[model samples]
Target chain A: MTQLREPLSLISECGLPAALEVMGERWSFLILRAAFNGFVHFEDFSSELGIARNILSNRLARLVDHGVLARERCEHDKRKVEYRMTDKGRELLPAILALRDWGLRHSDSAAPNLVLVDARDGKPIAPITIRAHDDRVLEWGDLAWAEPGDVATAPAEACAEEA
Target chain B: MTQLREPLSLISECGLPAALEVMGERWSFLILRAAFNGFVHFEDFSSELGIARNILSNRLARLVDHGVLARERCEHDKRKVEYRMTDKGRELLPAILALRDWGLRHSDSAAPNLVLVDARDGKPIAPITIRAHDDRVLEWGDLAWAEPGDVATAPAEACAEEA
Candidate 1:
C-alpha cells in the first residue's frame, strides 16, 4: 500500500483530473467494473460491455499502459491475451462502488442487479464514506480545505475554531 | 442517509453505467470537484475550469436536468443564476474524492494540489475504503459476489466457505 502524502495546498491541485485523464472515457469505467466482477478475456469484456472490438482494444491498451491492468499472453493460445487487474487496479473498487451506490440511490431505476459482499462475513459492503481518523462519517458540510501547516496538532481548538 | 440494498444479480444491473450516463463526460467530474470546493456561478466555473462557454453551458444544463445541480436565480440579481449542488450532487463527492485519492497514489504527477480535511476536527480525512458492517477494511481477495438470498446472518463461515 502507498503511504499517505497530503499536499501542502488544496486550491490548485488536479488529483481527480489526473485520474480522469487516465480513466475518464465513458467505456473505461465500465471496463473496470467488468474486470472487478471477474471478466478477463477480451471477448468477455467486449460481450459483457457491448463495446466495439477496436475501441475495446484501445481502451484495454490504455488501461495497461496506465498500470491499471496487466496484459498477459494466454499460455494455451499464443494469439490470445488476457487482461488481469493489478493491485493498483483493485484499489479502484471503492470508486466504482461509490458511483454504483450513488446510482442506486438517485437513479430512476428502481431495481439494481449487482451485490458486492464481504467474503469474510457474507454481508454486503456499505457505500464508501469520507471518515475521520477516529472513524466518524463525514458529509459535505463537515469538510473544508486547509493548508498543511494550518493542521497543527498542538491545539485542537485552533482548528475547530476555523470551522 | 440511504440504506444498503443488495442487488439480486451483478451481471444484469446497470447501476454504474446509469451513473456514468449522467456523469461520464470528461468535464462533469471536474465540475463536481469544483462544486465541492465552493464554486457556484457560471462565470466562476468557466474561468476557474477554463472550459469553453458553449460546452460549459451544455454541461451545466445537463447536470441540472439530471437533478445533480439546482439552478436558481441569485437572490439579489435576477439575471444571474447560481448552480448549487443537490443532495444527489453532494453524494458524488465521495466518488470524486476516491478518484482523487487513486490519482494521488498512482498518477505520474508527484504533487497533488488539494487536500480534503474534516472541518470538525481539522484532521485530514483518510482515503475511502470499502468496509464491512463490522468495520474491517476489505480488498478484492476479501470480497465475493453472491445472490441476495445467499447471504445469511447465521454464520459467516457459510459465506467464507463458499469462497
Candidate 2:
C-alpha cells in the first residue's frame, strides 16, 4: 500500500477585500484623490467631485474614523476644520497611484487627463510595478502563492504566462 | 492693474473613478481575487464567498459587462458557464496586487496570512513602488499634477522628504 500527501494549499488572504470594504466606494476613492491633491475643506471636495454636502460629510467622517484621515481644527480659523492624511492614509498612496496609472494608460479618454509629474524634474513618474528584490520586473507568470510558515522550498509556478 | 492669468490647473482624470464604478463594490473585488486565483465556475465563487446566488449572479454579470471578465460556456459541461479574466481585467493586476500587499503589510492579522512569492526562485516579490524614469524611488514629496499641455519647464519640489 502507498500513501500520497496532498500538497498543502495556501489560503487566500482577504487584506485587499478588507481595504475595499473601507475605501473601495466610488466617492471614497475620489475624496481621497482630492485630498491627495491638496483639497482639505468640505467645500473643496464638494466642488471638485460635484458631490452633495451630505454625501461628502459622510465620506469624510468615515475616512477619519478608519484612521485614514485626521480631522483637526484649522489653525487659521477656529471655526473651521481641516482633513489631512494620516500615516495610515499615506500608506495607501501606492495602491491609489497604481490605480491611477492603470487608468491613465488603459482608459479611453476623449479629453486630456491630468498627468502625474515629478515635482523636481517635470518628467512623468514611471508606472508602478512588482519587481523582485533583485529588481527584476515580474509578471503574473513570475508569481505563486505560499502559505505562511511553509518550508521555503523553491516555489512552483502558480500558472503559465498568458499569451 | 492687469488681469492675472490663472496658473494652468490640471484636471483630475476620471479613469480611477470609472474603475471603481465597475469593481469598487465590496464583493466585486473579492470575486476578482478568486478569479485571479483560478476560480471560474459560479459554484466556486458561491462557495468561496458564501454570497447569495442572486447577488453573485448580479456581480458576475456586471463584471462581464464591464469587460473585466469574460463569460463562456464550460468545455467540460455543455450547460455550465465559466468566467475568465479578459485582457482588460488582467491589466488591473498591479493595482489589485498593490492593495493586497498593503493589506498584508499593514493589516492587524496576528496569524500567518497568504503571501505572494516568486514562481521562479520562491522568493517574495518586492513591494510595489512609484519610481522615476531614471529608476529613482519616489515619495509623495516627489509628485505633483501637471496640466497635459503645460510647458516642459523643470518642476519644483512638491514637498520635503518624510522621515
Candidate 3:
C-alpha cells in the first residue's frame, strides 16, 4: 500500500478552524519562510525549497487568496512574477523570527549553520531577542535580536548553568 | 486582474526542511500543544483546538503514522482510539518549546491567544526565552523577540507598553 507521509488537513466544516488550518501543512510555512528569505521568483522558491510544481502552484495561490503575500512581474522578464510579503504576511514575521530563534537555540553547532547577524556590522544577535508589543517594542528586551553571524549559547547548558 | 501569492510546500520533501516545514503550521503545532495541554480523544482535540473533525482525524492518523504519537483502542470504548505521545513525540519537546517560545515572543496578546504558562504553576514562564548563540549571547538589545509575552520584564511594563 502506498503510504501518505505528510500531515493531512483538519477535517471539518469550520472556517475559523480553517483560518489556522491552511498554515498547518508543513509546506505552508516553508513557502512563507522562503519568501521572507528573499526567494520571490516562482522557480527560485520551487527549486530552493524543492517543492513539487503542482503543490507549489496551489499553496502560493491559496496564500495570496488569504492575503498573506503580494506578487509582481519583473519588467525585464515578463514571464517571472516576484512574490513579496504583505503587511498581514509581514505580521507573521514574529512567527518566523520565533522559528529562527528556535532553530538557533536547538540546532546550535550544526555545521554550515544558518545564523542571523546584523547586516551592517556583521555581528551576532541574541540574549537581547526582540519582542513585539504591538507595532512597537513591548519592553526593553523586545529589542533583543541576533545579528547575521551571532550565535546563542547552547540551550542545554544555559538552563543548567543559569539555574 | 488578480494578484498572485507566493505558495507554500516544505512537507512533501524530506529532511529537517520538511520536518520544520510541516510542523511549522499553526494548527499542527496547536493541536500538538492542545494534546500537551491534556486533550486526548477526538472530540477533546477538536473542541479545544477548534479544528474540524476530518482534519483532526487526518492529522492524528498522520501523526501516529509518523511515530510521533501512538494510539490504543479505548479499553472502555472499543470504538474510540486514545492518543498519547510516544518517546518520539515527547522528544518533540524541543520543537514545541521552540514554537511556544516563538509564539510567546510574537503571537498577539488579544484573541485566541497562544499563551502557555505552566499549567502546573500560574506564574508565567520567564527568563527562559530561547536564544541564538555561538558562545556569546546574540545581541540585538531590544529587537530580539517579536512578542511582548516573552519579555522577562515586569508584566505591567510589558503588557501595557506601547508597541
Question: Which candidate tops TM-score?
Answer: 1
lDDT for each residue of candidate 3 in B87-154, tens digit (9 for 90 to 100): 55554544444344433333333322223222222222233232333223222232221222332333
Please give, for residues A1-163, the per-residue lDDT of candidate 2 as tens digits: 0111112232565577557656765478878877888888887777777777988888898889888999999988988889999877887888888887666556576644567777877776666777665556677778888775772653343111100
Better of 1 and 3 by DockQ: 1
Residue A59, candidate 3: Cα error in Å is 2.5
RMSD of each: 7.6, 10.1, 13.7
| Model 1 stretches astray by more than 4 angstroms | A1-12, A154-163, B1-14, B111-114, B154-163
At residue A38, what lDDT does model 2 achieve? Answer: 85
lDDT of 1 by residue, A84-133 (tens): 99988988888988888887778677654546778877887655777775
Error of 1 at B87 (Å): 0.7
- For candidate 2, the per-residue lDDT at A147 reads 75
* Model 1 residue B2 distance off true place after TM-score fit, in angstroms: 29
Candidate 1 chain B weakest lDDT stretch, 10 residues: B1-10
Model 2, position A21: C-alpha lDDT score: 56
Whose TM-score is higher: candidate 2's or candidate 3's?
Answer: 2
Q: Model 1: which residue pairs collide?
A: A10-B114, A13-B113, A113-B9
